[model samples]
Target: MIADFDVSSDWHVAAPYGFLRGLRHEQPVFHSPHLGAYVLTRHEDVRAAYGDAKRFSSAGSLTISRSLTQATRDRLGEHGSFLSSFVANVDPPDHTRLRRSVSRAFTPRAVAAMEERFRRLNEDVLDRVEPDGRADFVPGLGHIPSTKLTARFIGVPESDEEFVKSHVKDWFMLFLSPQPADRQLELADSFLEYLAYVDRLVAARAAAPQDDFTSLMTSLIGSELTHREVVELISTILLGGNDTVPNQLGNSVYRLLRENIWPVPADLTQNAVEECMRIDGASLGSFRYAITDIDLHGVTIPAGALCLLSTDSAAHDETVFDDPETFRIDRPNADAHMTLGYGIHFCVGAALARLQLRTALDVLGERLPGLRLAPGQPIAYRKSIVGRGLPALLVEWD
Candidate 1:
């Protein structure tokens, strides 16, 4: 079965566990002809790669240079250079300063201050769904608070939420998702428009300071970061913060309901969330480029080789978590999941994510304890390589 694995196949992208497990067991570090990169499947190897940023550069982690065809590159023109500036893709020294500057907004103290706001936003959204006995959780419950909170956090006007959301996915696809060069060119057009919009937003925030994230970046423009850097960081946040949380929302809730574990105990809400992250996290894994010819597990990855660290597969590695496939809310090492990443690259917005997710579960369970997956509706995940997300989750509460 391992010999039959195909990374680019629609079946694998939509549901990768079978293939990933095969890779981890049969070949922990296996090269995929389709991906033109090595795949690290074991927990130990994947975690080590994330920590060894020096050896594995983050640049080209999302969008490999070879993926950009000549036509696509020509279309991107000067704006093409900004792709490397995304906070997640930059290496070491540059990443350090950028992360520090933005860290103020996501500190535990700052995130704690946001709990009350998060709770209210979650409540407002759930309140609408309570009247109906059944609903699709994706747009109705999952995306509502996430979009609203992220917009408000970043100083994007609520009126423009739909506009921002519309373009964020296309931007994600342009970099993370594999598509034909012609399609990438089309995506680049929308990406440039969105980039320009963020540039305007950054300028506006600089001109009239506000009590939000954009203004905070603007305040540090000349000293710690450049105007263009601020724009890139904001664009990164918008892209990063937008999809993952919404996907996590659907994934967490979907697991609980499917496993018949609803009405999670108040004391175990955090544990429940962590277990979800371990087993059914939103993101599959991130990409990195090996800086030197390296050997691991009887395989040698050439210098400059691309590696897809399978954090999802790592989470399910039997060596890391005993009986890893089972969904256990009380799992002791659940929080160790690599879904949000590891080491210096760990997600900065983790605090915000936790606050929102915990609030989502608490509010939904308290108000709709009877929640259950609607009968006769099949659950379908998005056809995304990096993100494991449900497009819609039908549920009902009596």
Candidate 2:
């Protein structure tokens, strides 16, 4: 009997590469009833699909919960009103305008200017951890710096950094579905609180100018944006500035420790960072809608069909990288990994993230060369249909 792909199976999330290996070999384009989105597993197909944005429009509900998958459809239903104001939902001319407006802030030069500050902050985080010799790297060291950077970029005062970071972390979990309904409802509360927080920041910035993204937004387009739009955009960047980086750093560190690759060679640090992402990146996949009928490797994806571009699987595609399962920081093609994606929708914060990761590896190697996962502590991953990350990563050093 032939076995069809099951995206929601435990094997897929916990040990996805084994299952993804089968996917790339046999079913490059699969539509699972459980997932509802057409899964593109190979690197070439995924990149091509991403490039053909006209057919694979990103507009619509970007949730990973296959609401059409029976039980989810009945329980959670679908909420389309969520991102009407989100910048990610916009396409073409508007995407062009909004991205251009903020592009100046995330440029390589801009991010470079701010590097020393964050480097010092991350180093300080590790410095404080050195005394303990053992620390929960996730929130202890990871999320803290991201929270500070979020405040720095958003132009908010860091007085309530801890308070806001707590809420932002909660808000970040909203993207992950397939969890209990109770957790979903709780996240709703956190989301509202965060929105209110951003709203207050928006109002405060409009009243008194500050040198930050908030101040920049209030003056854009003759200040024609509604209060609602400003709130939505700020919330969007809050996810960018707070959510992804923390988990990414945690995940990267987790990979290094698990593979016994700590004190990684200096020359291979950059390649190691990319290799970690190639193995298991923070993002599970991104969502796109088939605006028109599309054909893939003998499968027909009907118009309006939801598409899950499995970027994780793409990195594991054997044709793209030799011995894909092996973690080799020396792999020269590590930069080709598509976790940040390609084409017009490539990650805007790539430079900042790379800078942070590069700096983080440097600090870890320098400060605690003997870093290893804490003994006897069970590491846990926060499951999300759209991403993968550790809830806590405890580590110790000699």
Candidate 3:
């Protein structure tokens, strides 16, 4: 069974549940040549690996796909090794310290305070499309609000929005995918440019602080972090919210309408969002490196082995979720899905993401209860192993 499963095939990358379901039952810890990692499909195994930081280190989790060529390294110059201080790619001690420095921005009070503004943003975007009675929800409804709010939160100037938008995907591709040396070099140039822009923003904030995320980090530069660390930290936060929210919004809205669960009651909007996350989440899974030999179900993952913890597969495990294939907005255990993450490295922006999802649902449900997918439009998804998302969702309402 393991011999037949090709993790990189277009079929599997576009929709992998069928193959993953078989892997969960036959070989839960099968190693994949494409990913060069032992894939864990069971919910229990993935969750345990996530919580055990000592056994499964997070270092190099994102960039382990391939090594950089010396030419690419030279192109990067000082920016060649930027992930050293990224919160998601480091273990505790450094991870704890770095996470603590930005923890205040995500506190409940702070996140709650953004709801009023978040709602207005969603309403404004939806209002523009309501008169059309049809629109590509991905960009028209999803991307606009998410990008605007994230940029403002991170202190990106309106004048630089196009620059940031055009290049952030390069950062995503460079770190998240395995590419050829030449492609890597191209991405390296884009990344270095982005780093320089961030460095400029940091220096400006240091000289004249503002009420934004960059200013917050600049204040702690000498006290809690170094200049380079602050630059990498802000870059991580900027990229963190960049596509994840739009991807999730696209996923959630697609599920709600396709499954006829729209107009989710005001009280159950959160439950509906969790159900969408469980059934069709944007985050497929993430990588973790093994620190020591560990045996699971008669398979041994050797020391320093890379592991792909399949949260998407775990969310569909029959043992954990009854009638796993069914999309039920009222499923009692929908919140148990590991889409956001688990344990210490759980998503720091979970609250803000939820706020955006809930607000979108409320605004759409109130205004477009008749919403439905536009007929004759083939459903398509971006071919990404880590983040599952629809690039465009053509929607219509009476």
Q: Which predicted model would earn the best lDDT?
A: 3
lDDT of 1 by residue, 1-398 (tens): 46543545567755677778888888888988777778898999999999999889898586662366778879888877666776788898989998899897787887888888878988898777789898899988888888888888899998888888888878777776667978888888988889888988988987899999999999998899888888888887887668898899899999999899888899999999999998988988888999998889888999999898988899998888999889998999999899999989899988788888898899889989999999999767777657788889998999
Better of 2 and 3 by TM-score: 3
lDDT value for model 1: 0.85
lDDT of 3 by residue, 1-398 (tens): 44544545667656677888999999999898777899999999999999999999998787676467888878877776678668888999988988898886788988888888878888888778889999998878888777878888889998997788767878778766667889998898898888889989998998999999899989998898788888887787777667888898888888888788878889899998898888888898889999999999999999999999999999999999999989988899999999999988899999898888998889889989999989888877777678788889999998
Task: Name every residue pair that clashes in candidate 1.
Answer: none
The lDDT-based order of candidates, best leading, equals 3, 1, 2
- Pull out the clashing pairs in model 2: none
Model 2 whole-model lDDT (C-alpha atoms): 0.75
C-alpha root-mean-square deviation, each candidate: 1.8, 3.2, 1.7
lDDT of 2 by residue, 1-398 (tens): 22544545555555768777777778788886667778898999889988877788876545445223333233333332445555566677666766676676676777897778887888878778789888888878888776788788888687866667777666555544544656656665666776778878887887887888888887663544556667767777777767687778888998888899988888888889899888878887788888988888899999999888888889888899999888887898987888887777788888888887887888778888999988788765665667778888888888
The whole-model lDDT of each prediction reads: 0.85, 0.75, 0.85
TM-score per candidate, chains pooled: 0.95, 0.91, 0.95
Ten contiguous residues minimizing lDDT sum, candidate 2: 66-75
The per-prediction tally of clashing pairs is 0, 0, 0
Q: Give the TM-score of candidate 3.
A: 0.95
Which regions of candidate 1 fall more than 4 Å away from where they truly are? 4-10, 65-69, 180-185
After aligning candidate 2 to the native by TM-score, how far in Å is the CA of 310 from where it should be?
0.7
